[model samples]
Target chain A: MIETEQLTRCYGSLTAVDSLTLRAEPGQVLGLLGPNGAGKSTAMRMIAGFLAPTSGTARVCGHDVRRNPVAAKKALGYLPEGAPSYGEMTVREFLSFIARVRSVGGDKGYRRFDEVISRLQLEEVLDQPIGMLSKGLRRRVGLAQAILHNPPVLMLDEPTDGLDPNQKHSVRMLIDAMARQRTILISTHLLEEVHALCNRVAIIANGRLLADATPAELERQSRYHGAVSFSAQGSGVSREMLARIPEVASVEVDPLDGRVTVFPREGKPILEEVQTLLRTQNLEVSEIQLERGRLDEVFRHITTSAHPGPAA
Target chain B: MSAVFAIVRRELLSYFVTPVAYVFMVIFLVLAGLLTFYAGDFYDRGLADLQPFFDIHPWLYLVLVPAISMPMWSEERSSGTIELLLSLPVTIAQAMIGKFVAAWLFIGFSLMLTFPIWITVNYLGDPDNGVIFAGYLGSWLMAGCFLAIGACMSAATRSQIVAFILTAAVCFLLLLAGQPQVLDFFQDALPAKMLGALAQLSITRHAAAIARGVLDLRDVTYFVASIVAWLAAGVALVDLKRTR
Candidate 1:
């Protein structure tokens, strides 16, 4: 539902968003992962028509953001970073104002307002002034405003920034429920959020896109280098002996627990072989397990090892 | 049009939800009453007309209008809500005009609260109600002029204090342009016709003409043109800042 062609935004000498071209299809949630000052928010703002790109163009549902901003913006809902809102207005008034501005007319507007309020669980604080609410509740109010028009595209920047654990869980469930109907582009530094909520992930660094892939695919690519841990008690089967195995690259003995951590070569599954060796040596094997690959490890490997180049 | 009306209603409602609007109203009404009754010599001037009441509007608006309008755009910018506002589907022109009209109506409402003074004039003696009505019309138009300038200045800075100061400085210069002392200073430095044209651009001059019960089209056109010019600048500035 949204596409950008070589989009760039430069502020004097510093480029906020480089020639970044990306797309999110309908009913797809694209998680934008980036470090601080990585142009993720700038990219989202360009797509939302809040900031004009210095070069190239962004289109929403096939409408150019610059040439036909009104139509393009009408099809998109944006929740800016920091959850910025009019502090003087009550939550209901603010949502109503956004509904009117978004042109959700007639019974549709009221229906949309009711749907978003209940979806975001903002019915309890609907009449409270926004300035009086906590950060988590205020963020929900911001979310309510964005979805009140039921736009086709939703661009959220750190939608779960300030929420507590329970609130965050509810918000994630809400987002997952809505993902079946709308295109979502979520920008956040939280890696687990991407794994839990997004079907596809785009990693950006220094105004560039480094990698874009599904969460499982990204983890599998990084898992070519894996680690295995097992416990055994036997005579003459030392941790050094385990390290000397052809497939094993390194071994470390836990100082307090005396357990060994084994790093195996790529495409090597030595668990059964190690068990057989223990049996042949008449050793007592305590535990044998494979460490599951995590998205955090992949995120670090992608951002740190990958070269910082212009966005694709 | 619905978007514009939505913005107008929201802005107007905001004024009442906080103490800003109430404080402004109290200050404006008190000062307007005190200036007209005590300073303008309303009862002691030996005139049954409201000339004294209408005469103090230029100076009163020089301060009150800025106080009301300084936070209109500056607060939005400072609080980061400007991003949310610009992201809406409404164009910058619609938002600017909507905010300006809302502030103008607020000032108009405040001015209307001075009706007791109008009543007092009619109760004491026979005065020309047409002239009083014309004076009110002229005052309301001049208030619009001040609000337009204040709106543009508000758009220029994120600091409301700075906006208020800049608006006051510009408005004070406009008010003093046609005064005898200022004209005398410029008479020797510039050509006579150029100086005359500069003086004619002063809001004080046109406001005075209308306050004297003369509804000259040129004076009316001057106020309208001034409002349009400044509000247009406001719209352009909003666009520029949003793009940045």
Candidate 2:
């Protein structure tokens, strides 16, 4: 539903977004992960038709952003960074204004407004001026405005930036619910938000795409891939015997729990041997699990790499 | 267009809902009264007309109109609503024209509220209603020209104070271009033909001529053309800044 071809934007000598070619289909939540000045917001703004690209093309639901901006924007629901709004306007007034402008009104519009207000829990503050609201509430109002028209494509730049923990979880849940029908692109520096919400992640730095892959695929690229840690009950199984297994490369004991964590040799599956020891020796096994590698390490490696990394 | 109307509605709503509209109207009325009564010396002149009242309008608009229009685009830029507004399915030209029209009508509303002075003049003397009506029209058109300049200046910067000062300064230059005392200095520096053309470009000259009840086509076209040109410039500036 969203596509860009060499979507480059430059300001004089500096390029903000460089030759970025990407596509996000329906029902895919693509997390645009990058640090500060990483061109994530710049690229999203171009796709939303707010900023014109110096070169290349951005399309929304098959309409070119530059050639047919109005139509392109009609299919897009954009939440700009910082979640700015008119301070003097009340929440109801602002939402109504946006709904009218977006042509999402009459019975259908009111129903949509009611649904979003209640869903975002904006009922008590509906009549209060937006300037009086806290940062988290303002961000909620911003989210309410974006989804008011039920556009098929959503371009949210740092949607969870200023939200508290509960608000962030609710927003993630809301985005998750909408993901079945919308092509959602959220740009953020939060790696956990990507791990929890995105099916595919694209890492960028210095206006270039660094890595693009599924969360599981990205984890596989980390050194922690296929590692396992287990706990034992009632005089825990010996860590020495567990380390002697052929597939085990490194073994460390958890000082707090007396559990053992094993890093298997490269391309090795050691779960069978660890389980066999429990059955053969009659050891009381409490817990055992396979670990998907940490995304922060993987994100760091790709974004800060000296050379371009592989893309999935 | 509906999109244009939507923008106009939002702008007007903000104007009336905030304190800016009321404060501007009150100050505008007070200044109009002060200019017509004290500076223009309405009773001391003992004239059975509103010539003095009409004469001070250009100067009155010079300062007051910019205050109304200085925040037209500057506020949006400062508050970051410009990005939100531009991202919608509206053209740059449409948003610019819509906002310009709203501010013009707001000035029109405040101008219409000055009808009490017109009524008082009629009761006090046998004033020419035709000339009075023409003066009001001239005032409205001249105010529109100031608003266009203010809007363009406001779009060029994100500071409302800067917008207000720059617009007032530029309008002062435009007004001075028409003055006889100002022209005396230019006569020695430039040729007569060039001086005549410079006088033709003076906003004060056209505004003053129209205020005297002369509905000259040239004056009308000048106001309309300048408004169009300035609004076009405002749109161009907005687009240019978005790329930055």
Candidates 1 onward: DockQ, in order: 0.78, 0.74
Give one digit per residue, the lDDT tens place, for model 2 in A1-312.
999999999989999899999999999999999889999999998998878899999999999998999999999999999999999899998998888788887898789999999989999999999999999999999999999889999989999998889999999999999999999999999998998899999989889988878988899988778888777774245667777898989887878888777788995988888788767777777888877788988888888888864465
Alpha carbon lDDT of residue A289, candidate 2?
A: 80
Residue-level error in angstroms, candidate 2, position B125:
1.4
Clashing pairs in 2: none
Native interface contacts kept by each candidate, as a fraction? 0.79, 0.70
**Candidate 1 lDDT by residue in tens digits, B113-170:** 9999888888999999988888888899999999999999999999999999999999
Model 2 residue B193 lDDT score: 96
What C-alpha lDDT, on a 0 to 100 scale, does residue B27 get in candidate 2? Answer: 91
Interface RMSD of 2: 1.2
RMSD of each: 2.3, 2.3
Per-residue lDDT for B139 in model 2? 79
What digit string (tens of lDDT, one per residue) describes model 1 on residues A178-275?
89989999999998798779999999887878888888777766553356666776423566667667887777666666666677777587766565
